[model samples]
Target chain A: MAALAPLSTYALRLGDDALILGQRLSEWCGHAPTIEVDLSLANLALDLIGQATHFLGVAGDADKLAFHRDALDFSNCLLVEQPNGDFAQTMARQFLFSTFQELHLHALASSKDERFAAIAAKAVKEVAYHRQLSSDWVVRLGDGTEESRARMTAGLDWMWRFVDELFQMDELEAKLAKGGAGVDKSELRAEWDRRVDAVLAEATLARPASRRPVLGGRRGHHTEHLGPLLSQMQFLQRAYPGAVW
Target chain B: MQDWPLWEVFIRAKGGLSHRHAGSVHAADAKMALEHARDTYTRRMEGVSLWVIPSAQIISSDPADAGPLFEPAEDKIYRHPTFYSIPDHIKHI
Candidate 1:
């Protein structure tokens, strides 16, 4: 077992996940395939950003944590930091992450920490909509034209490697889970698989073969992609420290 | 795709309200259309209920015939209920 980290660390991890993903989704604001899709992606981005604010607020100053952190200090899962490849790829990322987040939020709703429970309880509802929107797109694209089916397959393959990391248990989370203040994410894997598998089956798409899990985001280690993302995200803050609207 | 059909969206603001046309969305099917309507029109908690119908399915009277279709009803003053004496309890009427 590794040394226990503070409870704020746990909150920061969750916040980073939401913040980074929200930022990624916001990249689609004017670029989505359709106006409706653009609106929907923006809405999802707003919801995730709202969640991040609450979680990061619990950890400390939300603005400082969000704007001041370097790429190495961000504990968000690597899945979120991946570039939004295309529409299908974006939906695939959304499908996989939202499914896991909905379940995680559901579990956290029962947390012993009232603050965590309150945030999770409210966020779970928004995440449910995110899950539905993503899964529906997965099914539509997967079961549509041959070209669409092909793109959907490639999208899932691109994202499959990161699935395992979402459920990986770490020492900090383990200690918090033991105290009923956090979730034992590993326990949610079975249900995540069931839900994801159902969507794949309905989409008429095959599950991507499991590969060696990509790990280390929880420990502040990340793929090459996160650096550019952090650079872009932190620019306004770094350029003018303490600048505000 | 550009080939997707247009869907007219209707939103019911509350329990007792009738769904009114809010706007339109483009989608491949009814299910997708409904979701599109929800995302497009109801993001601000504007509605408790929603309805989406294929724009092609809606039948509209030809504008050229507007005089024959509706002008005759404009002169019917008896259709108005203003002559009725309302009791104090009948606030809604």
Candidate 2:
């Protein structure tokens, strides 16, 4: 492994994750359940987009990196591309992703590379709010009422299969983990387990029993879902090329 | 599924800075209130800190109270800083 190759790839992976999820959140713009929620979704989308900009820009491939590249060029894990099911589904995905990302960002804040560390430091602040927001929703929808509870549990259940994608370390991640540039996804697993358990217990939702885990996001092999997402995302960029407002 | 109460936001621009009331947001609960407060008030790098209170929980000073409660202070010249000189090092008022 050449010096910094893995780290750059690792950053690109995370950046793609943020970019895809940001696009998903933006889809809910002006269509959130309430005005406050609309703004909340909008705000989260912006935060993720900001992260994408820093990470992808550093890669020197922001366009081919995010908007212009083919799906295989993407390094995002599978969990993000899972359809935004319902509000409960969205919150469940958010809760899990935020919890994972918050820990990842926290570890990255202390990276040996000053640039990566600075990016992490700025990012963790925003990720903290995102984690809190998602966890709160998990509790609310889980505990609120019979219908709400049912919907939320179902949402979590439907999305549960995708959770393993968060921990799927690729060849690059494994290589980077040997250095301090990357956090051990295994260490993140423990805290993620505890935080998720507590939230689910409070939400009155059940964690899915062990199931077959899905993989392949890091290497760019993905479910059919990624295609539509890429098509929509790339359309403007492909069509406009260099058009700017 | 639950109707979270609304909260009004206030932002303190820096540490030790006064929290000026900013604006309001709707949230599903108290936790959401805090997140929304930070997002709405701090997005432009405008605030270093935030305060959020349920809109339902606030008690306000009214226009009716201004004459009696605030007018008297306007005449207290000693309370004004005209008599004293502030050091150049003084940062936030």
Candidate 3:
């Protein structure tokens, strides 16, 4: 065997991001500000879950990877778990995450591995929709009323610090990039910034200055938020493993 | 306070198609009606478009009047294709 390329650590990381965001989005299933938006978010959540399944299923299956993994094993960054603050904050987190994911998945679509490329190609379309959905909301909520604008900017301010964790590619990512299984996230920064800046401008929000970079999530550390999220999501599944109704 | 009115949902599966009646939901206004329709009915990618109208505005006829409104058209041969000569060019029909 050619060692199977160490199970594509980068794919695992991407899967973590999708799986977590899917779980997060599922939180809005019934309580969205409007019912149309509720359905829209649910559809997007399903898409993310589907994409996560595609990536996590590459090695085996997503169910096993998602519910079976412990705290230290997850590779998702901290930003996704920061809770849905307000409408604007939710959109801001989504806008930033989807913008980042759009470029990442686009470049991954060209991967030398056919399976990876196919997954990325399919996922890019879904993420494009996600980015558009979030961008639209960001503009509306950011420019809506005085209170809403303040909340939107405040949400973005709180969320911006976690963004540095997203682009911190390390040795595993470097190996995967060299092997053509993943993109060098470093090469995608300029495009990411341009897209983000344009959306922010349209939203009439400013980016917060960062004093330092954040990078603990890929190494198994996350904010206090993810634990509670996982507990709720995994509770029934964990309690009734292999027990089907 | 009175509750919101009930609205029936009709959905178009795709463009250039008819909107078939799907179901009903309760909403405070037309916008809320549409929003509730989307959430309750279209979450599964079930329809490409939707129409939500209050049930009271549907102007449905009584079941007793069905015979008068619909039964007369049943045996109208002029309305049917039974009078038309079969042409070979109209193969599918």
Candidate 4:
């Protein structure tokens, strides 16, 4: 296989993150607890899919990259690929991921690469809303009835191990960071912690105790959940072979 | 979910327009109601401003009072400025 250029690789990684998360959120389209919540989740999914299109388009044909890639080839962080266990679980995952994404995208909006900067600029606004929506749910569920609090706590615990992998800067990212083309994700951790902590405090929820970090999505390894997700997402394109709307 | 209060959503389509009733949503409180209103009504660039009122708080006119409230106005056609003979150049008025 031909080696990808550093910029192409960077775009592909970010694209994968958006695409996978969008697919997960799209699962809530008709099944969310309420019609209003359903529409909101779908709106968030559409925004992520749109962001994926821009980022993946920078690497190559967006459809080909999204529909043709296997699970082992995707570089999304593990947090996004996890199942939407329930409303609280989905909110926990979205809150954690969007908090980090908002910070990282804000930093990338000023990147030396104009394409990255442009995409990040637009996407950061959408992510800001995602963060707000999820954070509100976290507070509501965490501070509500006893059952809600237990479920929210469990949801946070289920996702906490994957949080560390989001900030792990690989050598490629380090090199790109030095060159001003990519963000140093490691640096975003402090603010992510501060913001996440504040929300947890408001929710009256204790932060999950840190566990051994589950890593490797950046290196194309993923949790068992991703394979099934990709199979569902890629099924139509894979079966039809170049079908169009 | 069924126990949540209903909110009537009003959306101002643009800066100069008054908020018009768009639809209704169900939410636990004022904040969630606003968020729900945005998600439900404004996804298509339809509004610049949003207003969400608890459905119970809006005192709508009774259908049984239609004759007493509205039929009295039907014969007062002079209330509308139809007698004005303005030039065609005055477009809106």
Note the DockQ of each predicted structure: 0.81, 0.38, 0.24, 0.94
Instruction: Please give me the total number of clashing residue pairs in predicted model 2.
Output: 1
lDDT of 3 by residue, A64-85 (tens): 7788777667879888887987
* Model 2 misplaced regions, further than 4 Å: A1-4, B1-4, B58-93
lDDT of 2 by residue, A1-245 (tens): 12336667877887899999998888888788887777888999999999998988777667767777888777788888888878888988889899999998998898877778899999998988888889998998888889888888887877778788787665666666777777678678989999999999988778878678888888778888888988998898899886668
Candidates 1 and 2: which is better by TM-score? 1
Tell me the tens digit of each residue's lDDT in model 4 across A57-167.
998899999999888779899999999998899999999999999999999999999999999999999999999999999999999999999999999999999999999
Task: Specify the poorest-scoring 10-residue window by lDDT in model 2 chain A.
Answer: A1-10
Q: Give the clashing pairs for model 1.
A: none
In order of appearance, the predictions have TM-scores of: 0.96, 0.84, 0.78, 0.97
TM-score of chain B of each: 0.87, 0.64, 0.81, 0.87
Tens-digit per-residue lDDT, B5-93, candidate 1: 99999999999999999999999889888888988999889999999999999999999999999999999988999888888887865
Sort by TM-score, top down from the best: 4, 1, 2, 3
When 3 and 4 are scored with DockQ, the better candidate is 4
| Top candidate (lDDT) | 4
The lDDT for every candidate, in the order shown, is 0.93, 0.83, 0.82, 0.95
Candidate 3: clashing residue pairs, number: 0
Model with the higher TM-score, candidate 2 or 3? 2
Going through the candidates in order, the fraction of native interface contacts each one reproduces equals: 0.73, 0.47, 0.33, 1.00
